[model samples]
Target: MDPCNRFRMFLVPFVMGIAFIFADVSQALALRCTALSGDDRYSILYTVQAMHQAKIQRQGALITVFEIGGGDPALNGALLYIRIEHNDQAFVWKTGLNVHSIQQLSTGPENTLDIRAKEDFLDSNNMVISREVSYKIHFYLNNDTLEDAIFVENSPKIN
Candidate 1:
């Protein structure tokens, strides 16, 4: 084989290999969220409960994550810049500005946020929800302050 042709052939495969690796990595980035529901209200406005420690994990992986959430009732928009901090971690996670459009909390339930496990919670695009892990959720009632953070425990209901 000519030296120039051989070099070209190697380069093509090298680039193709790199591209394939990236494609596989990207495929791991997926969000698997469960449906949540609850009917709670706030004094000033009103609040509803969503999923509890809902785990969004990679199909065959594990991730360190905490479910933090917030939404505005007055503006009827997802309240961003709200505070969300972990008990063991010092860094705080700011709530995203995306919410469902509906007037008043529904009698039924709905999915709040699509929980996806990721390598870094600080980066949205790096998430890959793990389906093997379970999530825990906390609930709370809002009056006029943001100090109230309610956490609920999920257990097998006894009929």
Candidate 2:
């Protein structure tokens, strides 16, 4: 057998294996929000109390907002669990925001889902230690995913 033939065989299998692994990982990360079982979805909804939803049809994205309520206003303003779904992939982020509204805004190369909220600066015990401020989180579309674009702009906003 030629040395080159052996090298080709090894490289082909190695490449195929890597591809398979990545394919599985990509699938695993996709459709997570939509794939939630009824029980799990209901559990989250029940525990979280208040929920809101918004959609971006152009980007094939859906966003669900869950307000984690119960604490006193002085102790905390709001904690929100945000789930963003684009096609089959979904991204989740948690932040200290009381969502006032959600809006779709676009300009040039940027298509964004803007979440308007009142943000509370809180302490360890969930107390609002500072003045509440208004914030707009802009989630931009990139390559069919809605997670990375907002990560940089909203890093400080997320708890």
Candidate 3:
């Protein structure tokens, strides 16, 4: 085997490996917001996280989980009024929970809310996709008065 040919073969694999590493790093650099909406007295918090899962005989998939909660220093066991609208779907909840309280409207508590997209959906080189999801959250006091209204337009991409 020629010495130059051997080096060329090794170089190709090494460069491919570096590209994959950079892609992974770019994905990790994506912004992640855990705080959604809040007011002077109360707040409506949200968290979004993604995880990649492998499937048998199929391309891997990305699963995103969403968690929403109500928070206030003066809640003191007071019932909170929360309304969440995702992609025009509405969910309402009233609870006396604190900041750590998480409510999953569509799915079970253990499952929570999630959006799944193909692993290849993201364009690594471009880094500009045309996919987005919208959300609206409203926080209210036990007295039936609105505390804060949060409207998110074209939030993080789903694809």
Per-prediction TM-score, please?
A: 0.22, 0.45, 0.25
User: lDDT, candidate 3, residue 49?
Assistant: 24
Q: Mind giving the per-residue lDDT tens digits that candidate 3 earns over 52-156?
A: 221111211112222333222222111223343333333334322212222222221221222222222225563423322222222222233222332221214
**What's the lDDT for candidate 3?**
0.31
lDDT of the candidates, in the order given: 0.28, 0.49, 0.31
What global local distance difference test value does model 2 have?
0.49
Worst 10-residue lDDT window for candidate 3 reads 54-63
Tens digits of per-residue lDDT for model 1, 11-107 = 9978866764564354344322221223211121233233223222211111122222353332223321222223221211223222322112111
Give the CA lDDT, 0 to 100, for residue 100 in model 3: 22
Q: Could you give the C-alpha RMSD of every candidate to the true structure, in order shown? A: 16.3, 16.7, 18.4
Predicted model with the maximum lDDT: 2
Model 1 segments more than 4 A misplaced: 30-159
Highest TM-score: which candidate? 2
RMSD of 3: 18.4
Candidate ordering by TM-score (highest first): 2, 3, 1
